[model samples]
Target: MTTDCSSVAYFSMEIALDPALPTYSGGLGVLAGDMLRAAADLGVSMVGIALVQRKGYFDQHLDDLGNQSESPTAWEPEKVVEPMLPVVTVRIEGRDVRVRAWRFLIKGLGGHVVPVYLLDTALPENSPWEQKLTDSLYGGDAHYRLCQEMVLGLGGVAILPELGHSLISSYHMNEGHSALLTLGLLEERLEGRALSSATEEDIHAIRAKCVFTTHTPVPAGQDQFPHDLVSRVLGEERTAALEVTGACPAGSLNMTYLALFGSRYINGVAMQHGEVSRGMFPNYPIRAITNGVHAVTWMSPAFGDLFDRHIPEWRHDNLYLRYAIGIGTSEIREAHVQAKRRMVAELKQRTGVQLDEKVLTIGFARRAATYKRADLIFRNLDRLRWIATHCGPIQIVFGGKAHPSDVGGKDLIRRIFESAAALKDVIKVVYIENYDWRVAPLLYAGADLWLNTPQRPQEASGTSGMKAALNGVPSFSVMDGWWVEGCLEGITGWAIGHGPESPDDEVFEIAALYDKLEMIILPMFYGRPTAYAEVMRSAIAINGSFFNTQRMLSQYLANAYFRPAVA
Candidate 1:
């Protein structure tokens, strides 16, 4: 299980390898951790790089009115990760700042391990201001974010050699956050050459050694720093050289643009996202590779045992999950029920909400962003109350956190609370506080249906629904993100509308959501138990088998990593 020195060096801003490690804010970091875990399982030669958030991503709390509050996450990284002896330095604002690293070994099912190196800027030798650079995840101003990215990109590249990974043939930028690594590569190429000038051949050579994955489709999601800031942070000479090579444009240093220019292979996380990205950056070539979840990590213990008994090969080869259809419907129902009971008990313990296990439980847990439409289900409260009274008894489990700065996201949470109170007599609703890695699995496995309603195309590649599928829970989502491909109407799960192309898309989608729940979903759950279980089995067999990191890593191996590096 030892990786080759010439393995792919995967760089991301954060890595959520474990619940105890709060280095991740949301899906992107979780996805990075899953990718590494799968890479280890399949023996894909790779090492991951990220920043060690000492203060960690903030702990989420909410008031009685659903007003969000933030608190520092207290955890000891030394307790979880092994510290490496070597220290590297990268210049920031004309001053040399020292960087250290810690390694967390992610052991896969096959006894293979992938080492994730977390770069840290907190040291006694470094200035007090520099020491606090690695203090928080997605905290601080734009300058602070730029510095953190530098520690991950420049410092990560520098320390790899010190950690005996000098021969890394390719660098994979998981997102634009780590695009500065390309600059480190460029500097290495320009060694013994003029710093003010860079040849096309040098740029081409660096591009050949790199790959980039863009997760966000919207313009605001892309990180863009002013050119003056880039010059101040990374030296004026280096900035001028980067401009010469077309990595940093004239006005601003667009991180996504830099990555696109420096990478030979660039991809979006989903098929629709790829098309959207091509429209955004028509000049560059971009391919689509739909994202996937790590099956073993996401599967509930109850379903895990079920899969172990039925689809034994699922651990090593997730494609074997397709055999889940062979498992009896009764067995699937029992497993799902057991998982639901467990989640109910946990939710009761945490939030004091004793949800009915027999009721049709709907789960909606993701980043509480405006476009995610957390309040979409409650748009027509009168219709919702009618459905609850006539169709069936239902309970909802809401779990997610809004960014401290996003007032709109926090307002959505407040709206949900208000709706929950308004419908308290008709249906039960519970909003779980501090939605993290620990809470995500419980909600995914416990709920009868996983709900996702994003404003089309905004959701790049959501994997929460995929996790629910592994646990025998069907999704009720919009035709966006990975759901665009994973959704198989009335089979695996239900779709809200076709796509976002319709002029009355929102009207159509909300109506469809109500109609499906009232007419189909609730009736099937309460009346036809065997039929409901069959759909659950199909979810595991079809969506769970295909939407997994095992398949995704293989695609990367053939299409990106294994491609010959340029000289």
Candidate 2:
């Protein structure tokens, strides 16, 4: 609403604009937010749209033994966001649900501001159930989910014009959750033409204005609704429209298929993910634009100050970070020491856990999903104990939240707690409770090394390691997601498990992790400090420079937003 001249609109289920605002759940929202910030930095005419989740993704609470519990983590819209004027209605379950929106401004490089509109449906004008439709994110049953998506996709399109975004030439759907925006686009393209008369040309026109990015690599992760449910939420006419647009197949409404059918340019988060997605969909041309973090936002004060002194242009042009290769290795060490000190101080204050700053600390934190294999490092406790005993003094910092419904993910956290208990005296292992955007930076910059152990091909494009790279923290991760592209062996960071196709064996992956930690990573950190610093320097010079949202948005600008379709 702040920018009436915007020509591009990016839609996602959630966006991470502020730490106080819990609208985002995890990586998807974080990536979405980073793109918008980079759009501002690049001075692009872009506006962001997402549902304003009232309860957010819930406040993750972990008990002493790592047992997880959840509660509604609500934030008042009026407090953090400014109310906008446009109030629209989205038809759900044969009733008109009133919807409103709020505005949040994201300040990017050189103080350029990008506006993000958060859609809200908690109006008093609607029914009690309708009022609570946007109350919680990822809450309720299938019906509730369909209703929320309706509010997000359908309602988002309707409000854009009222906010003076009618000239929005491109619609970039971050994922399938907002694929219904294509349906909204189809209706808008009609331009008073009868809905029944909508043809392939109309759908083609809609495709030209739309782009989609599929983030979910697993089948169960995609959203789908039965025809009965689809018919109930969306009337028969819209359901029929979906068929005409090929947005819905005969069996059920698959959100991913709808997005694929409606998009002109489709992409996966990483090259490997793109290959996997193409195999799954088979028909669509799904390309890969690897994910990245906001350089300025994710960079820690220590590294940020260092970059300011050495590479002043790094903030404006993230690619300038490649010049960080010239920065003295000792300076990298000095900054990392300050970052680790800050993290150690905070850890002691919050959890009463005092970790030695000199100890080799490895950070592993993100959404606790089964594919991530968060406990893979603890597979052989004796091997790990021997590594600490012979290799060097080591500590591990763990933090992340599992969805309330993911029983396996919750169980993984408990296993980590048990592993920590088993190795308490040998390694100072700690799991921070209620991990969020605020706690992420400390781990990224503070750790001596970043660790990721995702199951083969499941990771779409992990950005946390990229964020760590910006702060000169080298990754020791499984060769999946962005790591496949970013890993330069010992130059950027170490690798665990081989390539995506090597083997899906867990024992092999664990051995790779333990072997590297014991034989490679720990020894280098303890014995060859200067050599380790050089690795960190390359991580920033190479991975950090290229793996940033500024570069990501520039790619989107050329490939999606201002492409031939718009011309």
Q: Write the per-residue lDDT of candidate 1 for residues 103-157, one digit (tens) a residue.
A: 8988877787788898888899999999999889999998999998888889989
- The sequence of per-residue lDDT tens digits that candidate 2 reaches over residues 205-226 is 8888889999988888999898
Error of 2 at 169 (Å): 0.9
lDDT, model 1: 0.90
RMSD of each: 1.9, 1.6
Off by over 4 Å in 1: 1-6, 245-250, 500-504, 564-567
Give the residue spans of candidate 2 off by over 4 A.
1-3, 191-194, 565-567
After best superposition, candidate 2 residue 164: deviation in angstroms?
A: 1.1
Report, for every candidate in turn, its global Cα lDDT versus the true structure: 0.90, 0.89
Q: Name the lDDT value of residue 223 in candidate 1.
A: 85
